[model samples]
Target chain A: MSVLGRVRARPQATAGVALTLPVAVFFVVFWLVPFLAAIYLSFTDYEMAGTPNWIGLANYERMFADPGFLNSAWITVVYTVCTVVPTIVLALLVAVPLSRPGRLNRWLRALVMIPAVMPLAATSMVWVIIYSDRGLANTLLGLVGIDPQSWLTSSDLAIWALVVMVVWKSMGLFVIILTAGLQALPGEVYEAAAIDGSGAVTTFTRITLPLLRRTLLFVLVISVAGSMQAFVPAFLLTGGGPADATQVLPYYIWANAFPYEHMGYAAAMGMVLLAAMVIVSALQFGFLKGGDE
Target chain B: MRAGTILRAVWLIVAVGFMLLPVYAMLVVASAPDDTDLRGLVFNGFHLPENIGLLFGEGNLPTYLRNSLILCVGTGVLDVIFSAAAGYAMAQLSFPGRRVLFALVIGTLALTPMVLVIPVFLIVKELGWVNTFQGMMVPGMISAFGVFLVRQFALGIPKELLMAARVDGAGEFRIFARIAAPLLKPALITLFLVHFLAQWDNLLWPLIVANEQELWPLPVGLANFQSEVGITYHLTTTAALVTAVPPFILMVALQRYYVAGLTFGGLKR
Candidate 1:
């Protein structure tokens, strides 16, 4: 057979290969190459001004001893827990009622989701205003008969302030997700529970929670992964804060790579972040799957 | 039952209010008189146009907006096209390396761009694309999420249709363009909006790659405005409002598709 005939004989194989080439090529150049380069760079000392020199795990050792890395790791855990837990709970609280079928509920759901769609940088700017001493937060505090307090400037409160903004920005998406999960649930189960004289709280705890475990796990994994690498809010709003209180992992990596010229160290930190995310996701999957029985 | 209905309504209203308060506060500050204090600015002033004008007039916000548009539109179009083509192949065609490619794409989905910033920047610098539009747009062009979304939608396309086209001696590309592309409109729209919003809101990558005023996108531009304008709430909030307008309009207009896109990955699993 001629080459054209040979190729034409299996249209699926030829066309599939041809069609997949663009994304494959792009992914290789953009993602694969960069990913491997990050791994390689983590082991080398590459100042922007010069060629990289292989240093072989020195960067990793330095990170283990680095106070900034330790601070950022601690902050990452705190930030992730603060943002992820509230986002899941608040989203669930709002999504359950909004999941009901009605035009008004749909509109209300859209309204609540508006913040999730806003540009984080812009929203962070709004938050900077809100968290300012004279901003609405303090004003609202005054309404409650409390003293006006500096929010972002206070080390103890800066990370918490960021947590509030992140939850506002992120929870809506989870709400939508959980709402979908709620809608997908079998109505027959709820009907059975009602016939059995199960109360709302009892049905939710005994049935709804267990049934929605997979969806909840999905939300948990995504939220935790996102919060671990959060950068823009901390950078734009706090600039890593008054005493580095809000210096999460990604911010620390950025500061090292750009401002401090510690490219190897930064890449090493990125590897750590990648590992942390994988571990967290794996743990969630394992725990959730174990509960299936 | 009546009490339950009222409680649900109240809960939703409170949630929506909490969600919108920051946005509403932003609008109030953006429209307030320049020297007004935050306490005094209680959605009373109506100087939105003037503040917007000042934002574009005194700063490089217009340039930033233009650059951002180019970046977002470019990323969106390319992401859609690339994802559709690849997704169609993965979903319909039988090819070698298909499984491995899908796995690779899925793997990339787990690796957030934030973790790859330093190496990606190095790659861009190596390619001589720093401070260039390509630098800002290319790495963001083909997200694994877009590919996965398109592939899932493409799986629903009837295989017989493609076979019939093949029997009629239609070209593969022609079959995709004539059949698959039209059928994948909803998914394509979802991918486009998601990619557009992502590119529009992206800050850190652009901040690193583009240092020139003309190359700055809205997010970076808004960040710089904070430093340059000091504590001028009117101008800063005005700039932020402008930065937010595109995605906000998109979300409001295409809420269904946008939400579908948001929940696509989660629900599919």
Candidate 2:
């Protein structure tokens, strides 16, 4: 008998299959079914109170035309860019030096991860206090000879304030991830560069950046997805407020679905968000294809 | 030390200070007397116990804390067990459709919680599980990332050990229980930490499904209290500190496992 046939005939193999059945079935029911339902609900007007009515493409059409949806989509893009770029740059700055093996660097690394481990809801509450009129942030700004700007109350500044908090909260994990990538880099390349008398800037730009492309891509994609789906800061700190300045897509979806009962409309917006994430991830893979080689 | 090393040391200290500043502010506010001036820094410890006591005595925070513990611990244990079992199967067994099953698992990784929230709520509603503990916990019991991580670790286990046990007429369950389970301890611990943190910090889904005040978890409860009371910094900061203490303790105690799991899950190549 063929090896495949022999393996299939064994009771142990059947046991393995049986062991996997519970999770697989659970996922199918909870994950796969709901995912399909989300798509189906996107195409229909399914209010929680009533049965779904078939209304193909109308929800998507409304999504494109609605000012709230358009504004949220724009805000989401801006937030993602603002948060991801600064996070990667700052994390890289901290991580490169911290990657050096030392007692101090090790302690610093643990210290930085504290914010990332804390619950965002709790942290957002703390930030709301900091952004208050007579809060510590303003006190620090006053010491630097600046005015106490309204952080979460200003239309233009609220989104930026949210960005700052998010970057602070998330940078630790990225720093750790990038540090691992840095430590994994072969030291012989650095030695060769040093022998050639390559300057620090040139070595970093040429050797370190190119080799860390895969890790950078990983960080970038995760950060973009995270920033896109961010809800706690908006919900807790600003309530997507100061005239909807910080009203990103996920918050918009929540508003429409729960409070307004526009479940179908929310589902359509969610589909758009999913599509955007998939496209971003696919483009990242395509762009970084040569990094592995 | 050289000038460059000194500069780097200064920068590291500043970075650490920046990271801890907000937390320090939280501690100050939570522990400050209610009528104290809120403008400048007031680091006091007199009101710490009183504020925490008020949070529990005046509000439903103790119930929320209990619910959070139930959900996080329940989901953590279940996620580890389910993921380990499926991971072991994919690693050691030669069953048909294994490749397809594994691919499906990986595919689910791309589906974020935001995307699943609405439909999952609908499913819970359909099953009449809204406002219940099982509603909050059951749907999230299995994590795709956990399964992937465990599978990667399980692949490193030698296949010969399992084959040896099988040849000795031991049942597959016996081999898994007596042999594979112990070998998977490190991976399971890592997976448990990851799932526990995720569940512990979860806010959105719980807010949607558990509308009943008695059923609310820490995040949702804290958020509701903030909005309802409209920014009473002393009480809110105390609540925040109370909510943050569990994960803070866990991260500090199991720092290595927490860091490893996060980095491992992120840079899975």
Candidate 3:
């Protein structure tokens, strides 16, 4: 109490006070201001040009009935499932063996992370080329004497193509994360499984999978959160075309908010996405925390 | 052992191949001199220099690259510094409302900026920050993930070290610069790479904030390249390659930091 009193008595707390003020003010002006304004504007019919008129829950009600909104929500769910499952599984399978420290492991791990750091927009563009009818992918298929399927334009296939690109770009970070978990695991558990004549698959399923639960949950939570808000690739590659196949939630929000000037409706959609992310993340955290106990 | 090792090697080869295909394709398309054979599978001929010259000659490729570098460096430095300072405060200092502030930071991470983009656009418009680099980078300069990363590292530093410094008449800021900051070198480097990559690859915000061609970053610049050069695959791809190269170089050079920073958020011990 005396040390605290003495610290409070110091004059520097007042002088040093001014230094922290700028950061506080900066955070408030940029983050808090926009966030609070958004919450307010979400309840009002505020097109860009004029003053807002209060219309409570009208935006939310309209969003619920909008087929585009519903479709985007479904597409987002599918995208989340497609991207998350493959990324986590592939990363874990790659990671378990690469957990050890060695020259070969180091190089292999580096290779895995290459895609994770690549500029996504550039990669998406490259993918647009590869997914072209006459592009490298089809050309390679030609080598194998298989037909070149439309990857981007086809309504049935466009979202999957986007999913494939996302998984390829994002799986590296998952690998690195899962590999870290593998390395940090107690070696004795795997040794015990090995001594019991457990094969690779057996050890993986029995020993590794259970131990990596928390890491898996973390990856899933983040992936789901990210996928639910997918925008850039969907915007660039598909443009939500071919009957709105690749139109995910964030794309819907962007369209409504920016181009349509339906600020209130977009805000309602944003709130929905925000709720989805929060619920999924909370569920994952709760499950993981319970597992820890 | 032979079977398992072979399987692992094959799996790695396949994964690595899939991983580099985009990069390889970017390079291939960029370097292909003529549109004579867009259907070719083999990547044999490439006039990379010619394509690069063509792209730069087209419109503002050099300036776009410069703008990207400026925005990325500016955002990276400012984000890392602010996040580090705030993380240190949250981790070490017994300030009032610390819990609330920390929760607020973490909560910000949950609301993906994509959802906030419209509101942000309105705010930027209100401030008349449109078409400015400051407008592009300033709003993104405080990342919750950056704070989380720094805090994870800062928590590892002993309180005694800071106490000893304070006892020797070192101010809190001096102590941070002299002792705590150096101790956080690895973490700071990792966070910097993450921030730099995020900023470098950011497209939507920059697209919304700046309409001037001169202010466009690499991603936005590449998007416009195709429009301007209509069907000039070589020039477009070449500019795309230019956009792709910096992040690739950064990844290769700082692989450890990049990987660690990336996984830190997702992988708990």
Candidate 4:
């Protein structure tokens, strides 16, 4: 096309063309820049005071060698595993039965969403009350003739308190997601399994489980991602210790960056987190895909 | 069929029972008389008025409520408008590097403020927005999740609508305001509620940003309530119950929209 033709056609390009710059700018400065800067800062000593000295691999070397960092990393993995697996499985166990079409089932499914909307701080406070030595859990345990457990204050049990809170807080979303998956499954498969004289467990194991892989995968990824970055309940309830038991990596980053002002080192840890998440997720996705094939 | 129905009925009851317990416990504990020890799960009365009075009596709770209202509403309005503008552009506009732009928006979801809390604080410090309303609202205004959500919803609108509006000489902004905005109401409300609740319940950011008592939102205020005040289970529960009321009402009133939003939100990723 001639230059004049292209110039004359410019009027048509006006609408879509105008919006591109501002959106592109936001993407560059806020999203892309911060991310790349995080990566670059990870490799340097860029504390706010001094020029960001380029220190090759020292921060990472320290990270690997640091006992506290290693502990938190291990705790993060455990926390992720405990929270994600049971939340998905338990949600599915609850959802599949509740997926049946009925008024009561509808009510139950809707009721499950209450937890997801409850403010995390409030819920954690409530859990603190419930798990207190004199709280509801102990009261119940007393009814069963078992002694009260110090749920949140003890090192051995503090992280489990965190795990319980996370599971309860996040389980509602999983229920909603997996229930939708449950509702979408073909009824004929279940009917066919029944006709084949398969029992309830057999039908669920042989039929329903296989069909729900994608939803399960989605739940797994979100749960893992969410748990790895869990902040509210831990921050509120445990304060990252009864001896640093509940101190996950995000908490470490928060403390180092905000409280301690080790911005560059914290940035290094954040990069490590980001890389760990992406690599782990990519591997999981690949493994799941391979399994499906 | 009969056995299966019985089993399903039993399961539903159990699930609902479990789900309602904590909420029921919250209300029950809140309503218990101040001097009475609410060590058990049983519900009580006569304490609602007393506890509520305690919360609002000295104007402390009222201040927290007001701050929460300002932050939540401000964040909602700012997030929705910017997200709509950016989303509409992404969906309707065919500008250069559009793919890269959209990719960047989606990419931000994977990167959360937890990792960048310090850097963000630095940015807020540089802008002199620390311990200020602008600091709280402005930084959160550009949520990637909000933009991504609105853009996905906006993409469903037919181009013919925009073309027809253009044929009538309607300006881009006008079409968006008159046509696209109204059409995107459901998604807007969804995003609004999500962001509002998120901000309403937010702790770390608000705690980090707003150091003053007057500027503190409910979560931070409540946190301080436990620490600074004379700690009583009754008063704490009262504060917790009061904190939950706004979001509870919002979730109930917008139940249908909330469910649809959750479906769109959860599955969209």
Candidate 4, B103-184: lDDT as tens digits? 8887888886665666677777888999899887766766787888889999999989987886787777788889998998
- lDDT of candidate 1 over A43-159, digit per residue (tens): 999877788999999999998898989999999999999899988999999988898889999788767777788888899988888888788899888999999888899999899
Candidate 1, residue B187: Cα displacement in angstroms equals 0.7
Which candidate, 2 or 3, has the higher DockQ? 2
lDDT of 2 by residue, A1-293 (tens): 49844753587678778889988898888889989999999999988889999899999999888999999999999999999999999998888888878899988887787777888889998888888888888989999999999999999999999998999888877887898888888899999999999987798899988988878988888898898889888998899998999999999999999888888888889989999999998987888885567
Put down candidate 3 lDDT per residue, A1-293, tens digits, no spaces: 79855774353444233333444666677777777777788888988778889999888888879999999999888999999888888877777777867777788787777677678788777777778877887888888999999988899999988998898878877888888877878999977887899987888887888888877887888777777777888977888877899999888888888788888778777877887888888887897778665
The clash numbers for all candidates, in the given order, read 0, 0, 0, 0
TM-score of chain A of each: 0.94, 0.95, 0.91, 0.92
Q: What value does the lDDT take at residue A58 in candidate 1?
A: 95
Q: What is the DockQ of each candidate?
A: 0.71, 0.67, 0.54, 0.52
Error of 4 at B232 (Å): 1.5
lDDT of all predictions: 0.87, 0.86, 0.78, 0.79
Candidate 3 lDDT, tens digit per residue, B86-122?
7776676555556766777776766777667778888
What would the TM-scores of all predictions be?
A: 0.96, 0.95, 0.94, 0.93
Off by over 4 Å in 4: A1-13, A17-24, A46-51, A186-199, A291-293, B265-269
Worst 10 residues of 4 chain A by lDDT: A4-13
Q: Pick the lDDT winner.
A: 1
- Lowest summed lDDT across 10 adjacent residues in model 3 chain A is found at A11-20
